[model samples]
Target: MRAVVYDAPGAFSVREVPVPEPGPGEVRLAVEMAGMCGTDVHIDAGGFFSRYPLTPGHEIVGRVDALGDGVTSLARGEPVVADNTVLCGHCAPCRRGEPLFCANFYSLGVNGPGGFADCVVVRAEKCFAAGDLDLGTAVMAEPTACVVHGLDVLDLRPGADVLVFGAGPTGLVLAQLLAHGGAARVTVAAPTARKLDLARSYGTDVTVEIDRSDPARALPVLRAAAPDGYDVVVDATGAASVVEICLGLVRDGGTFFVYGMADEQLSVPLHPYEVFRRELTIKGSFAQTHCFERSLALLRSGRVRTDGLVTHEFALGDYGLALEATRSDRSCVKAAVVP
Candidate 1:
């Protein structure tokens, strides 16, 4: 089977590889549609860690082509989505019920060969029945699950006013979940007017176009939209500059969530005095944490729109162009690889 393999940093190829088969307590997925995410871009650029010659895709939707021994709970030929977390139960973090931070943490897409192939072998427990939706929509299940985890860390209060940075796929999903979590007002800020319009269609109360290079001008327009400040302010741009600027936009007692994946080498300054004086809560959310079922339900119910989110998709052979669309195209919110 042909799989997208990252040979080294800034290098990849769709090479023919052996088809994976299910092992005990495992299941083999026949790749249908896999979502290309920001993390994939980072991995390609050598910013994130990954085993070279890796099949890089975590957000996946496919059918159960085969099931391994002790995997009777699922049926053959059933459509499904795979969870990427693979935790060693004995690890301290797992024992503490926080597998996302396991001392020996590994994920399917990032740590090993994952969904970007004709077939992938995953633990049976990690495969959930695909929601009652088309492949394109079901592909969002993984990322949506991560968004649910972000909300988990946030502990949102009802009727809270919220402002989010970046109107990309993750930011837009965050906006919808905030609305569902009972936030009274939700505003999304991004560099693109097209995405801001997309956010509005998803029921965002306000949308602001931001020019990160000129925060002096953009910040004022954003501040005027909510003069009192917001109960929750989030940076989803994953840009160090944006994250640093978003710190001062939260209300005195409000919280700030770092929902974006910034480069590890980047650093920003924070004022300790202000944090002490205002009682601000700054938190960061990582990968999906066992939220697949609820996320799939929301997507299946049409509460979260998938219409414009998947702006581009390519066949397995066109993987090169697909990667380019993700980086060079500002209009491309999300791209998928269909096999």
Candidate 2:
């Protein structure tokens, strides 16, 4: 087997390694494709709870190569998506029906060996049948699951006017989810015209191309679109400055959802008086929990499209290049590694 191994932070290499075997209740998957995103970039920099000497790919789709003892629900050669998150059922959060906040959280690729290899083993229950979805689309299951969880947290109301910031893969997906999930009109704001153009096809009713460094310059344009402000404002850009701007766009008594992953040390000023006077609601959503199946179902049903979302693909040996592309390549929306 071949794998991209991270021996330490800011260090990695692709090398041949012995194939791993599955234990009881687990199955070994022959890696087909693994999706790379900003999270991978963070992991490469040694943040995001990443464990060293790890194979860093969390969004994965592969074929069942071998099954371990007691695993009869799946068979060899079946295509499936991996749910890299492993939760301890006995944890306080798990017992409270909040597995996302599990006290003992272990996510592959983040804190363990993952799918950035020719082969990897995961619990059989974590494997979701990809059905007939192509590798490109199936590999999106993890991200879509995160979007699903975000929507779940938002609990959006039907016919509400929505505004989303950022047009990245997750941002576009979240926009589509908001568009179809119940928002009467969904608007996307981003600095890139190309991504804004793509968002139009994914159920975005309006697209605003704002200058990232001077977002306020476009406020007049945005206000012209929604003079009363949006019923729900979301920041999917993960930039604290962007989030700060987005918070001011929420209508009175409306909700503001934070769906982007920002720097841990970053802080944004918030006026508690404004929130109190307006009776506003603020929410945040992290990585998913119990949403993988729904994401796959949405992809399979064509309700949530993945077209043009995966703009780049790389080979296993070019894992470093893939990470770099994901980190700095504005041309690359989503990068996939075909191991």
Candidate 3:
């Protein structure tokens, strides 16, 4: 089997590796497609600590090639996607139904071998069937699960106005979910006009191009577009500065959601006075858990546009090229590797 191995930070190589077999309660998948994510870039750049010589790809989808003992719900040749979070069911958080916060929670691609290979093994319990969807879209199950987490945490009412920061894949997907959830108005702010255009195509009601030098300028523009400040503001940029700006843009008593992973320590001016006066609620959403199945259902139902999100594709052997393209291609939304 050919696999892309992360030798170390800023280093990766494609090499022929021995094929892996499924262990008990596990299933081996012949990977059809794997999505290259921002986290992959971070891992490559040493932004996140990863085991050296790792296989780094989590947004994966494939057909079951073999199943180990005790795996009965899935059959060979079944198309599926697996939940990224690898949790210990006996952990305190898992016992409380919050596996995302499990004390022993780890993830594929980060803490274990992932799908940047010809075949990958996953727990049968984590796999969800992706009925009748193309491999390209099926690979989006992981990201969509993250979006589902954000949406679930927000709990916004229908017709609520939304302001989303960043027009990257996640932001665009979030916009679509907000629209599907009946948001009356959704504004997407991004520094890139191309991504803003893409967000609009995905149903963002308004798009604002923020000049990098004047990011704060977008706030007033967004407020004017929404008129009542935004009912809900989501910061997906993962930049501390942007998160600080979002705190001021949400309306009184409205909610602010932070769904991005910051690379550095974040320092923001506190507004305890305003927080007390407005009764605003600010929250953060992390990795997916218990949402992977719903995300697959969304794809199976053909409700949200996932195919268009794949702007680039590469062969498994061209892993380096794929990572380079993801880092440099401003117009690319999501890139996938097919094995």
Best by lDDT: 2
Q: RMSD to native for every prediction?
A: 1.3, 1.1, 1.8
> Which structure among the candidates has the greatest TM-score?
2
Rank candidates by lDDT, best first: 2, 1, 3
TM-score of each: 0.97, 0.97, 0.94
Model 2 per-residue lDDT at 316 = 98
Model 2, range 146-231, lDDT digits (tens) per residue? 99999999999999999998999999999999988889999999988989889997769999999988787888888888898899
**In candidate 1, what are the lDDT values of residues 186-295, reduced to their tens digit?**
98888888998999999999888888576445788878877878899998878887887786889898998999999989889989998899999999999876899888
Model 2: clashing residue pairs? none
Badly placed stretches (over 4 Å) of model 2 are: none
Give lDDT per model, in order: 0.87, 0.91, 0.84
Tens digit of lDDT per residue, candidate 3, span 37-87?
888888887666577778989898888999999999999999888776788
